[model samples]
Target: MYNRKDKQLAQKILTFSCELEEGQNVMLQLVGLNGIGLLRALVEEARAMNANPFIRIEDTEIRRILSETGDKNFWKNQAEADQLPLMKKMDAFVGIRASLNIYEQADVSREANKAYADYFVDPVHFKERVNNTSWVVLRYPSEAFAMNARMPTQRFRDFYYKACLLDYEELAGAMKPLQDRLEQTEHIRLKGEGTDIDFSVEDQTWIPCFGKRNIPDGELFSSPIRSSVNGYISYAPSVYQGKPFDFVKLDVRDGVVVDFDSSNNEALEEILDTDAGARQFGEFSFGLNPVIEEPMHDILFDEKIYGSNHLTLGNDYEIAPNGNESNIHWDLVCIGADVYLDGEKVREGRTFITDDLKGLNPENLMQ
Candidate 1:
């Protein structure tokens, strides 16, 4: 009952995540809506590969509970439980997201959510997850996500599915030129109409992650020094956790966000004020997927837009090979932005230098 596209998607997941090792234990957490089919297929694929797989499904009601109850202790306990066992047992973890609204629980007190968020992913958990497990964060489509992307539901769903089918190898190949440039550069600067930022990378800090834990695209990323950034960035008309932020501008000095400004939202203020570490830079990455044509307003999709890139402040997931700090992570994406490494233009306006890296082609993978 599987279509060829579905099979291709499964293969892409397996290849990119490096999940075929015999006797490896696999754990997957599926959020409601986006990744149901892919999760089902992935579970089966894991079994066929001789891996023991466990799956968990999380629903929106959980958000409702944390929001309505205002119980930080409950989430704290839950966080402990969720992470400790994974740290002890699982060899691989895969997260499949299909969220459209991050602020669905905005009604919850910011203080409570901040406490919960702070505790949810403990430092120990991050270290364990990053070091031992071969992990991946992948996307599935949903109506809410389609709306965020400004695309018709069916069309966007098709686009995501097609993107999922891209060949992992080809995508990595297309990114080699850019990776080469970034690896050789010591400092990279980002400037825009309302933003000017500069940061230095440790020698060999920028790394190219490919062939595992990523697919359909490859990116160059690094963990910047905790307090080394200087400048301002404005992200308006962007939504996070289902909440919209208008004209959000942040001023940075020595890598800590010194001043934060937002129009039409006080929630943004609360987020940055949560902790001293909240404003720290966590990860910097450039998107190499050429098929992603525009910003969908969803970090999962937008962060992968070809030639586009994003810098996440706070809480380095340690997903990249590089090391960064903090436990509060927020991704700010820039669309159609020009990306450079050592004065070489690797991407401009959503296109890579490689011609084959255009569009979501299964054969090319780079797109």
Candidate 2:
């Protein structure tokens, strides 16, 4: 039954997410063990579609070592010679990470990580694959992940499956009204515990993601017009790049981060200083995943916590570009936000109040 569930997920990934067709090339990248079951299933499903499936299994420790030791020229060559060429030949990409240690890269310097992102990640994956290929990235359930979620391994697996197997078609249907409202909205305000922020999404695209881009996905995202964001935000407890953060706060002025603080202030400073765009807002989104109600210290789940809102501090999606580009696209989540769209209160905390958008509230979506 466990492996069967994996097979079902693999089927969904190929058929629904990637939309893999016969003879198309798909590159599946797995970051750790414990996801071999799903990998096998993905291969099987891809072959069933007569699609060519290629696999790349990576070790986190090795990745950390390379990031720590590799230089500018090394990363440039790696991307230009290896990853970028390989990615260009692919029709779709699926990245599955089930790392035994999320903190494996903790000792790697921010400078090194930034170089890798600039030279390798930005050009190869973010620019080429993201804009060209049908791609989806997700974390596979494992004991390490369960520990981070603060749940028993078995219980967390159950939660994972339930969330991932949601009726996304129904959710997508439910999202239309909110999408309509957001598209028409020019100004927006968000208020919650220690959070009061305002931004503009005028003329920006509101992307409703239910199942295609991400598993366990239920969010509508739009990029803030660069230079339109103002005020401050207090994010919920979260983790980024394998480090835990608490009481993260940022004060923005004209879309740029003027002041920021967190449990590790030094780290926050380093991250924001990655590039000019790293200090500006790139994406704003509302979380509507009914099954996910709390933080797991993992952005994949926490950013989709029902009733939550998240903001990204770096690169915007090509589909909804704000012209703020960086090697990073970090998402910071905050719960308990009341949303106002163009001065009209549409959502009071976690519940959508407007008639047209009420279907997106958890109570209705749970049905």
Choose the strongest candidate by TM-score.
2
Model 1 ranges with Cα > 4 A deviation: 1-4, 67-72, 81-83, 99-102, 123-125, 214-216, 317-324, 338-367
Clashing pairs in 1: 101-242, 102-241, 102-242, 103-241, 103-242, 171-366, 227-254, 314-328
Per-residue lDDT over 54-156 for candidate 1, one digit per residue giving the tens place of the 0 to 100 score:
8878776575576567566766676667766655588887777655555666577766666666566553346566677777777666787777777899897
Go through the candidates in order and give the C-alpha RMSD of each one to the true structure: 3.6, 1.2
Which lDDT values do the candidates have, in the order given?
0.65, 0.88
> For candidate 2, lDDT tens digit of each residue in 190-252?
988788999889999999998787887989998998898998899988777666787699999
Which candidate comes out best when scored by lDDT?
2
Per-residue error for 138 in candidate 1, Å, reads 2.0
Error of 1 at 234 (Å): 2.8
